[model samples]
Structure formats: C-alpha cells, structure tokens
Target: MSTFRSHVWSSVGKKMITGLTGLLLVGFVAVHLLGNLTLFIPDRGHAFNAYAYFLEHAVHGWLILAFEAGLLAVFGFHIVAAVTVAWTDKRRARPVGYALVRNAGGKSRKGLPSTSMIVTGLTLAVFVVLHVKMFKFADHPSVVYDGKEMKDLYAVVVAAFKQPLIAGAYVAVMGMLGFHLRHGFWSAFQSLGWNNDRAMGPLQNLARVVSVLFAAGFLALPLYILFFVDPSVSGGHR
Candidate 1:
C-alpha cells in the first residue's frame, strides 16, 4: 500500500489529475460564460442576479457549499499536478532553449503549448481572484453613477464596463482563456482515449468550433455593454 501511494504520486499520476481537473474547469468556464451572457438581455441581468442570490442565501446553501468545495478540490489538485509536471519536465531538460528549431515535420512546437498552459493558467487564477474581489465582496464601495448607488450585481457589471480600463482588462483575460481552451478541449478528449486517426479529423474540427463559440460568447458581453448600452439610458438603474 505504501509503495502504491508513492507510485500514485508519480509524474504520470500528476499529469492525469491535471488533465482531468482541467477538463472539469473547462466545463465550469462554459457554464459561467453562458450565465454571464444574460447581462445582454434587458432586465435579464437581475434574473441572473436573483439566481445567484438564491444559490447563496437560500436553504439550499449547503448544496452551494458542497459544489464550491468540489470546485476548490478540483482547482487545487489541478494546480498542484500542473506545477509538479512542469517542474519535473523542466529539471529533465537541462538547457532551456535548443540551438536549431527542431520541427520533426508534421510535429507542432514541442514545448510551446505546454509552457503557454502554465502562463495562461496562472494569469487566469489572478484574474479570477480579482474578479471575485471586485464583484463578490459586497462591502466594497459601489461605483457611483448619477448620484445614485450602483452596487447590486447588475449595477456593478454595468459600472465595470463603463471604465475603459476595466473593460479592456476583461477582454484581454478572455482572450488568454480562449487560447487556453483551444488546446485544452481537444487534449482532454484525447486523454480520455477518444484519439483515433479515423476520428481525429472531425474531433479536431469540433474542438475548434467549441473553442471559438466559447471565446465569442464571453467576448460579446463586454463588447455589448461597452459599445451598445448607455449608462444614462432607462432601465439601467433600478
């Protein structure tokens, strides 16, 4: 049993956890992005907000707690496993860069995608923490508009995009998230034994389509809020 535990902590085991949890996180991102898109519909943001309020405050609070616990477990395992794999690989490769770019024809950049994963994942972690801090922390002063307090979930979102800096930051983070998912989604399927030469073609195409849709859906939110909606317009402040 002790020996088995050691083997479970091996590099391969770490990679497996990272891949699995990373896939789960991808699903979470899709759900979150879809929910966020509700902001585009007039009065729909409140509906979404109410849904969020219910999840947090209702008798089903324990269910929310359980879900959050599971999410945190997945995230923690994913991060630890990713870091272990990366560190192990780094140690194995003494020299960081190779002299000649070795493109063994038909083979993609050997380490680019893997390294990019770490960078993008770290960037997203920082973004998520800051995001929760901005929106989730209720006591944080509301971004005011027209001498009225704009502090509710809907108002905070509207106020957030009103600032060019905040809007651009979200766009930038979403772009990184898109790139991360572009590689991740297909890789997840491949990991789960779906990789077959006969089906690889269609699978790859499907992955691309899903990735694009995910990116577009998320990107549309800030774009619409910033460009189309006017803060001074009616139905904005309630």
Candidate 2:
C-alpha cells in the first residue's frame, strides 16, 4: 500500500490533477464572462455596478472569502500540477518525440496553443494578477446613484480599456487564452479517458468552438467600451 501510494505521485497522477483543475478553471472563466457581460447594459453601467455591489455586500464575509480562496487553491494546484507534468514529460522524453514536442513541424499539427501551453498559461497568470489588482482591490473614484455611493468600477475598467495599447494587449491576451483553452479542453477529456475513437473528432471541434467563443466574447467588451460606449456620460464617475 505504501509503495502504491508513492507510485500514485508519478506522471499520470500529476496529469490527472491538471485535468481536473483545468475543468475548474474553464467553469470559472465561463461564469466570469457571463457576469462581466453586464458591462454592456448601456444603462450607465448601472446593472454592472449593482451586480458588483451585490457581489461585494450581499456576498461578502466568509462565503465570498472561501469561494475566492478555493479559486486560488484550484489555480495554484493547477499551475503546480501542469508545471510538474510538463517538466516530467521533458525529463523522460527522447529527442525523437518519445514524449513532448511543442515545436516540431512548420505548421505545427499540434497547433500553437498546444505547443506553447506553459508559456501562455504563465502569461495568463500574470494577466490575472494584474486584472484582480485593478478591478478587485485598487482604490477608485465613485459614482452616486440615487444618492447611494457605488464604486466607479465601471469607469475604472472603461478608463483602462480606453487606452489603445491596453485594449490591444487585452485582445492579444484573449487570443492566447483561446489557444490555451482549445488544447486544454480536449486534452482534459483525453486525460479523463473520454476521448474515445468515435468522440475524438466531435470533442476536438467542440473545443475549437468554445475557445473561439471565449476569446470573442471577452474581447468584445473592451472593443465595445473603447469604441462605442461613453463612460462619462453613461453614469460612470463624472
């Protein structure tokens, strides 16, 4: 039993952990995108402000803390597992492709994201840190609605997205995110033994569609905000 326990800490176990945590992250992204889509309400960002307020006030205390903590744990565990698996694969592989080869062919039949998962994943981690600090913790000016003070988070976000360079950077990151998700999604299923012969094609296609949607959906907000919406006039911090 002790030997079996030790063996379970090998390559397969690490990859299984990565797959499980990857699913958690996918779900988190979906929920975050749905919530953030409220920025398009065009009601001077009232809907989004109210939603944010609700999340902060009503959802405050230990419950929200626990949820946030759990998310961090999932992310930390996923990063550790993913890095471990990647390193282990690197150490065990022959030069001729007995293991991993992110860069092999010209067109890369494995696709760019699959080949660069570690890079993109780490890049996104940096993005997440900056993102949370900006929107989640940074002090910002406020807006008054019906005599009530709400964090001018909408304005803050708009201000950030309004920068051409910032907007471009965000869109580019979204592209990398799409690439990561494309490979991660199908690979998750494969790791879990769901990639049957008959299902592989459909699963891969579904992964592609989902990856594109996530990128497009997330990118749309910044594009729309920077181009179409006028935050100052739309009830943001004026």
Candidate 3:
C-alpha cells in the first residue's frame, strides 16, 4: 500500500511539474512575442533598443534574471521529461517500422509533428544564441550611417535577413513551433486537470488559435524586414 501510494504520488508530481513549467514557458513566449512586435513601428529603433536596454539593465534587471533562470530550469526539465516519456513509450511498443502504424489510444504517432518539435526546438535554440550574439552583444559604436551615430540595429536586422536561407529557416522553424504548441498547450492544460469534456473541447480549439497567432506574430518581424523594409536606409537597417 505504501509503495502504491508512493508511485501514484510520484506520477502526479511529475505531471504537476510538467504542466507548471509548460505554463511558465507559454507566458514567456507571449511576452517575448509582444516585445518583438514593437520592431514593426517604422523609425522606432531607439524605442525598441530602449525597451531591450530596460530589460537588460533597469531596476527590474534582477527580476528578469530570476525569470530567465526559472525559464531555463523549466525548459531543461521539460525536455528531459519529454525524452524520458518518448523513450518509455517506444520501449513499450517495440514494433518493426511499418509504412503506417496507428495507435488507437489517441496518441500521436512518431511523425512529422514529433520530429519537427525536436528539430525546430534545436534550430530555435541555435537561432536564439546567434540572435543574442548579433544584437545583444554587439557593441554600440558611433557610426555614420545615414547621419546616425547610434547602434546600427536597423542594419544588423536587415543584414541578417538579407540571407534568404536564414529568412526561410525562420519561417520553417516558426511553422513547426506552431504545430508543436498547438498540441502542447491543450495537453498541458489536460495534464493540470482541466479536462472536462465540455470545457476541454473549446479550450483545445482556443489553444490552436492562440498557437497560430503567436507563430505568426513572431514570424512577422523577419518577414517584414526581409520583404517590405527598405534596406538602403541606414545601410540596410530595417
């Protein structure tokens, strides 16, 4: 009886952590997307830079650091748990690879969506590191670009997008991220015991909508810079 209770508690504990962490990540992504959207305002590079500067150096700097640390921990745990869950399921159903295998248990097969989640997560991680290096770490040198001695954030953004491959990569990764979140959001809610038949149905639909909106919002910045913005201005600073 004690062992049974322990096992039940452990499973519940893991699910609780997973659900909470997923919710935390969702909040972070929503706020990050909102901030990214600020770049869309024409000739507001200073505004965006100021916003970034506040996040990095304001009185709330320590708070942001704490939140980032928490996010990192949650992401690490989520990945570890996801891998563990996937491996365990695979082992339980060790079957030969067939052209098609269906699980009637309402579980998604190991297919494009699953593969894309892993791949895009990795790709986005790489992009994030590069993004920080290019934007955040770039020194603010006074340069005479279009009679402006400010940091050439506009140039940096345009230069990065000029590479068609990178722009396409961003779009692809964002698409995959949408798919991943479409399933993940509702799953997280369900795990947290918000799974009433009536409520869950509408919530699932809402999750899909929200996920696509988020993906579109994040993807728009690169697309705008790559396609619409005039690169010649400020030496390709969009």
Stretches of model 2 off by over 4 angstroms after superposition? 1-8, 94-109, 236-238
Alpha-carbon lDDT of model 1: 0.69
lDDT of each model, Cα atoms only? 0.69, 0.81, 0.65
TM-score of each: 0.81, 0.88, 0.76
lDDT of 1 by residue, 1-238 (tens): 9888775577655656676888899888888877787687676355546555666666657877887799989988988887787787688844222111231133453444445888888898899889878766656323333454444576667778988898888888888887777777666655444455566678668767877898788888888888877765423344
Point out the higher-scoring one by TM-score: 2 or 3: 2
Q: What's the TM for model 2?
A: 0.88
Report the C-alpha lDDT of model 2 over 35-122, residue by residue, as the tens digit: 8999988788788887777777764556667778999999998999888878776786531221122222223236687889999999
Indicate which candidate wins on lDDT: 2
The CA lDDT at 226 in model 1 is: 88
Query: Which stretches of candidate 1 lie above 4 Å from their native place?
Result: 94-106, 109-114, 140-151, 233-238
lDDT of 3 by residue, 71-123 (tens): 77888877665555445545865522211122223444345554566566556
